[model samples]
Target: MNFEYSDRSKALQEKLTAFMQEHIYPLERAYDDFVHANEWQVFPELERLKQLAKDAGLWNLFLPEEYGEFSEGLTNLEYAPLAAIMGKVYWASQVFNCSAPDTGNMEVLAKYGTPEQQDKWLKPLMNGEIRSGFMMTEPEVASSDATNIATSIVRDGDEYVINGRKWWTTGAMNPNTKVFIVMGKTDPNAARHVQQSMIIVPADAEGLKILRPLRVFGTHESPEGHAEIELDNVRVPASNLLVGEGAGFKIAQGRLGPGRIHHCMRLIGAAERALEMMCKRVTQRSTFGKDLSQYSSIRQEIAKSRCEIEQARLLTLAAADKIDRFGIKEAKDLIAMIKIVVPQMACTVVDRAIQIHGGLGVCQDTPLAMFWIYGRSIRIADGPDEVHMYQLGRNTIKSFN
Candidate 1:
């Protein structure tokens, strides 16, 4: 495989790296301070950074021409490194309108929405005029199996009435989140995977209530908020239904391929940052008349971290390449393999960084603990590692047979 990055990708990567250093990295502390000070509102500085990124033509790097509405239209392989750079700073992706839930939502609308639907939401979403959330996982079901979701979207004349309780609906708590792409059972009697449908529900509709934000690891409140909300007889135009009455599963499969790749790339960035911090800490601190780096165990940890990061990076790029070359369905095994590997890799790398720093690493003074939490969350978020591992293992066994 030709693993080398193209000139176009390299140029964009350099530009993105420079933007992160000059704009994003410097704002890390300030971003934390802003979040702490105004825990309820969106960070004003992030919006400003978004404008800067847009003006520089660095927006929506994840959406390729296959979608037709993406600005720069970079392929998954081309976008991987730039996304890796953004992953280094958790909040950086939003500046370029490349962050999650919205990215997945946009991909769905672009691929499935009717002309009128695109005009209403897709255009504004591409411009980053508003934010959105996906509501598929329900509080009452084993959500990893989408077929188990209990939400119902029943037709009522010109509109569909939706009812269900959903948690971990990431981004729903943000006031800026104007829409929700909800998944529910439209025809429970239909075949297992075909029973569900996705519909656009306006955030302001009556009977819709965003209850509270669920904390990740008892600390961080995802700015958009991993939220619990009630959609009690919420109503939307029947025209809001995407693709058809039983297309939610299909839409999810299409959206999640790119979404998983984005997550894996971001995890690599996080792991790289943790390794940087670990090395800096180990070398700068002296203990027992020598730098911590001189300790054999610490040196080994650093070396091992480097090896792990390189391996995970290569695997993530391979997954991206597979998605670009073959459709997501065709690359399911690789996608599952990377999904299982990257987050676990990041968690290990960040945990080591924390250990090297002693107390400071686990404290707010350093981002290591937060990085660790983000990595750990992904282990359960989206889906669990056990689930991916099971699928990957089964695929491997089948291939051998």
Candidate 2:
């Protein structure tokens, strides 16, 4: 019930807010230009910013110590605001090594990897020496129900031979993405959720082909682009298996609790920025000798957006608090609720901004179009809205009974 951010979180927020202003916002154009020139390579300036964030004690703020001794020891509730701040700038998370795929992959390794696996992959990922991707969603299946993942990782002597096609494997296209955390069926006949396992495959392993970068509404999120890759007879040592056979579903479920929170928090940030853009644009432009903000309908739209953002932010905060206090399984309903809610909220907010900006909103001149695309993508990503809604409805009905 206490919604107040702790002093630690408050302090970090001020620091992160300042960091974003000084380093991130100022370089949005430079980062975009660098990536345009490099074509999907990591922005070199990000390395300089990464060092800056590290020096300011803003590194790895996403990993809570519940997994291991490696994190900054902040709880999910504690990290939510910082995530929201990072969310304001799309690329801000990586500078602090708090970005997706890597954060989730790092969590899995910290929680489940063997000591040797930790020393090999975990160390470098934590240090931000290399990047990684999670290969779970398949092009051939309804990945929303992760049980439908059809990849195969069969045992072959001391190594596991992985074969299948995975798409929307975010971060795979990055040159620094040296490893992948892949999920595939090891025992097809096992129980529904227990049939799969997670294994680590090196990016350079034989038979693994990263085909091409996929686009979100014709815009590729370059550098950390989503990739469709084929894993044919890809092999990795047995030691790379996370937890053990039949543990993929368990790991995936655990991965999502925090991941969903991060997504929802970032969505809030995106919506906030879009709303700001909309309000600013509306007031600055006018028709018939009246400011757009003075128009009753435009004011209503702005008010509606503000209300929606606050509602979604509160729900996201509740979900994060639930995960931190009650464990993810107990907080499933809340998590699912926000998963279904935040992206929709962001989409609506950004769409409003786009409408207000008219031609400029949809153009590359503003971040609205890109933010809107990201919002729409998440509606289908991380378990689609329909899936989450289905679960939430069932849970609600069961609760009333």
User: How does each model score on TM-score?
Assistant: 0.98, 0.98
* TM-score of model number 2: 0.98
Model 2 residue 74 lDDT score: 92
Inter-residue clash pairs, candidate 2 = none
- lDDT against the true structure, each candidate: 0.88, 0.90
Please give the lDDT score for candidate 1. Answer: 0.88
Which consecutive 10 residues in model 1 have the weakest lDDT in total? 64-73
lDDT of 1 by residue, 156-253 (tens): 99999999999998888777889989999999999999999999998899999988888887754546778899999998989999989999899988
- Which stretch of 10 consecutive residues in model 2 shows the poorest summed lDDT? 28-37
